[model samples]
Target: MLKNLKLTTSIIMLSSLLVLVAGCGSKKANDSKKEISVALNSELSSVDVSLAMDNTSSDVMEQVGEGLYDFTAKGGVKPALSTNKPKATDHGKKYVFNLRKDAKWSNGKPVTAKDFVYSWRRTVDPKTKSPQSYYFDGVKNYQAIANGKKAPSSLGIKANGKYKLEVTLDRAMPYFPSILAVSASFPLYQPYVEKQGKKYGTDAEHTLYNGAFTLKGWNGSNGEWSYVKNKDYWNAKHVQLDKVNVKVYKTEQTMVQQYQAKKIQFTQISGSTVKNLKKDQDLTVRKIPGNQYLVFNVKENKLFANQKVRQALAMAVDSNKLTKHVLQDQSLPATGYVPYGFNNSKTGKDFAKQAGQLVQNNKTKAQKLWAEGLKELGMTSAEFSILSSNTETAKQVDEYLQSQFETTFKNLKVRVAAVPFNSRLSKQNSGDFDTVLSGWTPVYADPTDFLNLLMTNNNNNNGKWSNSEYDQLIKDANDKYALDEQKRWDNMEAANKIAVEQAPIAPLFYISQVYLKDPNLKGMMLGPLGQPYYKDASYK
Candidate 1:
C-alpha cells in the first residue's frame, strides 16, 4: 500500500527482492504455457489477512482477497467488491456500500456484504489478536473491542441485507476510504474460516480466494508458491496471466544468477550487482515511500532508556555514507521519520522537507553522548547487539552499523543478531530485541500512518518509548485539527520533529529498490510502496 490514497502501514519484516525477466533454458521448460516465475527473499509465512504482519503475505492477500475499494493507478480510489464509491453521510462519519452480485469465492460461494462485516469484526476481536487490530481505531467501538472493553460484534459495521453494508466511525476520517482499499480490509468468508478453524490460511487448500488470483502450491512453510488466475473472480476477464510463480532466493548473488540463467523473470539486486545490471533494458529502479529505522528497546534495555545513549547510537552511523556505499542503490538518507514526498502541505510542500533535518552524522557529538550516558549509568563500557533480518540486504546494512557503532564508541562493543524475517518480527513484537532494524510500509499515505505507531502504548510500538507531548501532537493531528488542513499539518509536523529529536527510534533511509523485469512482462502495477502487483501482468 503506497498509493496516494489509503496506504496501510503493514510491517515489512524483510524488504523483498522483486525481480522479473524473460527466461531461457531449463526455466522455460517447467513453466505452464502462460506463466512467469519471480523471486522472494524470504518465506511466505501466512495467508490469513488478520494475521499477515509481513509485506509478502500482504502482497499475496491483495491478489487473493478483494477489498471494498481498491487503489487506482492515478492515485484515486476505485470500487473493488463494492459497486461504486461508498456514499458518505453523517458528516463523513458514516458510509454505505453496495456489493457486486457477481463476485464469488474460489469455492463457488457467493460473496455477500456479511463477509466484510465478519472480516472486520474478526480483525478487531481480541481473541484473534490480529496485528491489524489497531488499523481500525477510527471505526466506531473498534478501540473498545480491541481492548476487550466491548465485544467484536459491537463494532460499528453491519450488513443491511445480502448486498449492502454500512459502517460508522468514531469520528470523521477523510482517509477512511483509503483504509478500505488495503488488504487488511479485505473480506473473508466466515463459513470457510470457521470450517478450517486453526488450519485456515495454513495452505492454498485451506484459504479462500475472491480476487484476481487464487494462491496455489503454498503449504505455509514452503519457499515456493503460485498465483493462479481465479475464474470465479468478478473481474477475471481483465486478469491476463494464467499463473505467476514465486520462489525464495536468500542471497543477492543467487538471485542474480537466477536472473542471468533466465530461471526467474524478476529478482532484486543491489551493490555491485545493480551496477552490473544498470544498463539492462528491463532493469527498474523505484524509490518507495517506506522507511527503515532502528528501534531501541528502551523499556527492558536501560542503556537505551538514557536519551544520550539512544542519540549517540543514532548519530554514530553516517546515513549518507551508509546509503551511498553500503546500500549502493537509490535509497535516500532519511531526513526524518517520514520519507520525502510522502505527504504534501496544502500549498504542496513535502512533509519531510517542512519538518527539516532532525538527525545528522556527528562523530564528536556521539562520542560526548556516549561518555555522558556511560557516566549516567555508572559504567565505563557497555555491550549490545543489533537485531535484523537475515536477508542479504539487511545483513549488509546491519554489519555496517555494527562497525560504525564499535569504531565510533571505543568503549562500547556491538554485535549483530541476524535472524530470519519471521523471527525478527517475533522478537520485535515480544520486545525480545536490544535494538532492531525495523521497516514500515505505509498502509496509507498520511503521516499519521507512521506517527501513530510510536504513540504511547501503540500496538506497533515494540520499543516501548513514550512521550505525552508526542502523543498529544499526533492526537491533535487526527482529532483536534482533522477538519482544518493547515492545523493538521502543523500537528503532524510537530509530532514528527519530537519523534526524531528524542531518538528512541532512529530514522534510517527510504529504499530505492532496484530490480530486473523482462520487457515482455507488462501490466504489473508497482504500488507506491515498491511492491509490484502481478494480477494484471502478462507475457508478450
Candidate 2:
C-alpha cells in the first residue's frame, strides 16, 4: 500500500520481454545443488528499498535487504539484522531496536542504527516523493516532515549510538514490529546510497546486500535477474541455495511450457490449465492476503457518481463464477474489502464471516437500480471503460467484468483498457479511466490497511470517493476505538459496511497463488504477505 503505495509498467518493454522469454524457454540451464531456477510474474520495478513499493520490487528487496526483523513463512517474526525483537517502552509507542554487531553489508560495512535512521528520514522527505512515506503517518513528526511543515532530521527516529536505534511514535502500534519487517522500513547504506546518488538501486552494483543473498548481474533493464548467496551476510551458513535465477515470463502458456520442459523450477499456471497440472504432484495452492477489486472514479464518471448505479454495477458481477470458473484455483470469494482468514481481534471469528456478503447478484433488483440511477442523472445512455493490467489473470477478469456490465445494463456501453501492470497503476493514479481493476497486497496484516483506503483524500483513494461519516468510522477504528478490541472491530465493520453499500469499490476475490514447482524443491515457504521467504529454502 506508496503508503496503498508502490510506484508502474512499460508496454513496449513488457511486450519485448515476453517475446524474449518465448524464444529462450530453455535458456539459463546452469542449475546446481547450491542454486535453483525461478520465475517472476513481473520485473523488479526498482531496487531502492526506500522507493520500492510494488510486490515484485519488495520481493527482490527481501532477498537483498534485511529490516530490523524478518517475517517468517509460518506467520511469525524472526530476528534478522536486529539481534532480537525490539524492546518497547511507553506502552508500545517507543521502540529501541539493537543491531547485531557482526551484521555487515555486502561491501563489508557494519550495519548500524544510523543507516535505518537515514533511510526512514529519506523516505519521509517531501522531495523524495516516496509513495511508501504515508506508512509513517503516526510516527512522531512524520506528518509535519512529510507535509513540509518541519525538517526531516526532526522526525521521531534517532540513533543513541552506532548500534542502537530509538524510535518514538505518537500512539500505540500493536503491529509496529511487523511493519518493521516490511521492505520500506529496511536500512540503507548511506555511503553507497549517497555516492551512487540517483543511480543507487538502479542496478545491483549500486546497492549492497545485508540479507541472505545479494542481487548480482542485474542491469536494471533486463527482465532476467538472479540472487546469489552473500558471503558477508550474518546468517550465510544456513542459506543452502547459493543462487536463484529469476526470469519474467509474460504469458502463462509459455511459463507452463517452460516449466514442463524442466527449464523453470517454479512458474504460475492459468486457472483453466490447473486441472491438467493437478496430476503432477508438485502443484500447490497458496492463499494470500491480497485483494483484487474494482475502483470507480465517481468524480470523473457522472454515472458512477450516482450511488445506485455503482451498487447496480457491483451486484451484476458474480464473484463466485469469476473465482470458480474463471480463477479455478480454489480462491475464496471476497465478502468485504478484507479477506476471509483474518480473525476479528475481539471475537476470534473470521472477519469476513462476521461482515458477510455485502453485494450479491440480484438481476431484477440491479436492473431496477440501473434504470432508476440513469433516470436520476437525466441521461438515457452512458459509456465508460474499465482499466486493468496486462496479465493472463487480469485479462480474464477484465473480460468477465466487461461481459457482466454490458449484458446487465441495456443502456451502458462498457470497454476495457489493458496495459502493463505499472502502466495500469499510472492510469489509476492519474484518474484516467472509469472503474479500474486493481489489487492491493497487504502491507501488513491489519483491517486498517484495507479500511484506511476509503478515508476521504487518503493517499490511496484514487477514485476520489468521499463520505464524511464513513471517514469518521475509519478514524475511530484507528484512534478512539483502537485500544478496545471489540469497539475497534465494530468501527471497522461499520465503516466497511458503509463503503460496500455505497459501492465506491467492489470486492472481487482474495488471491490464491497457483503454481507448479519441482517435486525436489522443499522448504520454499510462501509467507502470509504473498511472497516467498527464500532464506530457509533448500533442496529436499
Candidate 3:
C-alpha cells in the first residue's frame, strides 16, 4: 500500500534578486506613458508557453500566447480563438471546433486549425519529451503514440479545412474545455517555430503573439521584459494598459522593499513581513488551494516500504504549528489529497474523512510505529536525508520536521539538506533524494487534475509509486460508458483513498497567496489554480 501514493505541494518562498529597470522611477512620472509595472519572484526561462512548466514562467507566457479557449472571471470557460463551443458527435468520441475568421497571429498570419494539430502532435512526440505530455492521455490514440505503438498522425486530431479542427477523445471529458485553455494546448505557429530554429520564442523578435499583449523587448532568459499592446489582436481596443514592464526579484524582502519604495506596483509578502504588513491598508491577503507535501522515495529507500512507518511519520507532523507559527498566515492544514472547496461528492467526502482519520499528533503512537517498522526492516537506527530548497521557509519547515521526528522516534536520525531552488527542483525531478519538498499548481479545475499527477507512470510522480487498482479506477472514471457524473466522481474518490492509504506522501498545508498591491489596482481576480489574469486588470 505504501507504493501507490502521489504527493503534490505548492508554496512560494522569499528571494533577493531584483531586476532594476533603467529610468521610470515613479508611477506618476510614467502616468503619461502607457505602461504597467509588475514584479515577479524569478526570471523567466522562456516566453514559449508550451515549454514553460512553473507558475512564474507560465504566468508571463499566458499574456503572450492566447489559447483557443480561456477561463472567464467567474471560473467558466470562454471562447478565445474558437467561435463557439465544440460540437460533440459519435457518442462523445469526436469533437469539431469552428474557428473565428478574425483570429490571427501578431505577425499577420491566420491562426489556422492545423496549428493546434501540429502543436498537440509536437507535445506528445516521444522526442519532444514535454513534461506536460501526461495531459494528452485523455486524447484518443495519444497514449499509443507516446508508447511507440502508433504514428503521430494516428492520434485523432486533424484539420477539416483551414479553419475547422476535429479532435477525437478517448472518452467524454467534462473538463475538456478547461483543458484547452491551458498553455500546453495553446496553438503554436509551426512555420514560425521552424523558421526561427533555436531562436524561436527566445525573444520578442523571435516569435509572434496573438493575445492582447505582444512582447516588446523580451529576451526569454533576461530578467527584464516588456509587453506592448498587440495592434493585430482581435480585441485590441479592449486592452487598457499600453505596455507592461516586468522585473524579476529572487527574494521576498527585496520585492517588499521595492514595493514600499514604489519601484514596482505589486509584490508577494513573506517571512516577518507578513506580520508587519497584515495591518497595512495596501496589502491584500488571499488563500489559494494548492498544498505542499513531503514525497518519500519509496522506490529507492527500503524503510519507506512499510505502510506503518509512513503513517507514523505523517502523524508526527504538526501542520497547524508549521502554518500558524513557522509561516504566519492562515494556511489550511492539509488533511487529504484533494483540497477542500475543490469538489463535493459523497464518495469524496467519505474518502476525505477516512484519510483525515490517519493524522495523529501524538509522539507516543509515532514511536511505537517507528519501533515496529524498524524491527520489521531488521534495523536499529534509521538515518535518512531530506532535500529542501535553500529558502527561509524551506529551512524552517525542515527544522520543524527534523525536531518533531527526533522527539518522536529516538532511533531515527533525519538530516535536512538544503540547496538552491532550481537545483532542488532538478534533484526532485530526477528522484535523487530520499525525501523532497515540492508543490503543484492545478492546470485546470477538476479532480483528475490532482489525481492524474500521482499515477505511477506520471512524469510529475517523482517517487514512482504505482498501483494497479488506482490506475484502473482512473481509467474507469474517464471511460465514456460511465455516463453517471456521480459514478465517475465515486471512482475518483476511491482512487484518492487508495493514494492516501499508500502514504508515500505526507500532506502538509494548503498555501495562501499574500500580495501587496496598490489600492488603485482594480479588476484583479485571483483564481484557485494560480495567479490571476491581467487582461481585465487596470488602475482605478
Identify the leading candidate in terms of lDDT: 1
How many steric clashes between backbone atoms does each model show? 14, 11, 12
Q: What lDDT score belongs to each candidate, Candidate 1 first?
A: 0.79, 0.75, 0.69
Candidate 1 local Cα displacement, residue 177, angstroms: 1.7
User: How far out, in Å, is residue 313 in model 3?
Assistant: 2.4
lDDT computed for candidate 1? 0.79
Ranking by lDDT: 1, 2, 3
lDDT per residue as tens, model 3, 1-540: 000001111121111111121112346413733555776654555666556655655666667777778765555566788887765687766878888888789889988899998888887888866777777787999888988898888888899999999899887655566667777788888988888877876777888677878877766556667778788888887777777777665567766766667666666665466887888888766555466788888888888877778878887988888888887866677777765434433333433444354444667777788888888989898888889877666777899999888878888899999876546766887789998977665665555666888887777888777889998888777673246656677787788777766777887877766677766656755433544456666765
lDDT at position 124, candidate 2: 88
Candidate with better TM-score, 2 vs 3: 2
TM-score of each: 0.94, 0.91, 0.87
lDDT of 2 by residue, 147-257 (tens): 678999998899999988899997776656667778889999888889999988888887877888999878976877888999999888888998888877668788777
Query: Which has the higher lDDT value, candidate number 2 or candidate number 3?
Result: 2
**Candidate 2 runs further than 4 Å off:** 1-31
Worst 10 residues of 1 by lDDT: 7-16
Q: Which ten residues in a row have the lowest lDDT in candidate 3?
A: 1-10
lDDT of 1 at 138: 82
Q: Residue 265 of model 3: what lDDT?
A: 66
The model with the greatest TM-score is: 1
lDDT of 2 at 337: 82
**Off by more than 4 A, model 3:** 1-33, 195-208, 216-222, 345-358, 480-482
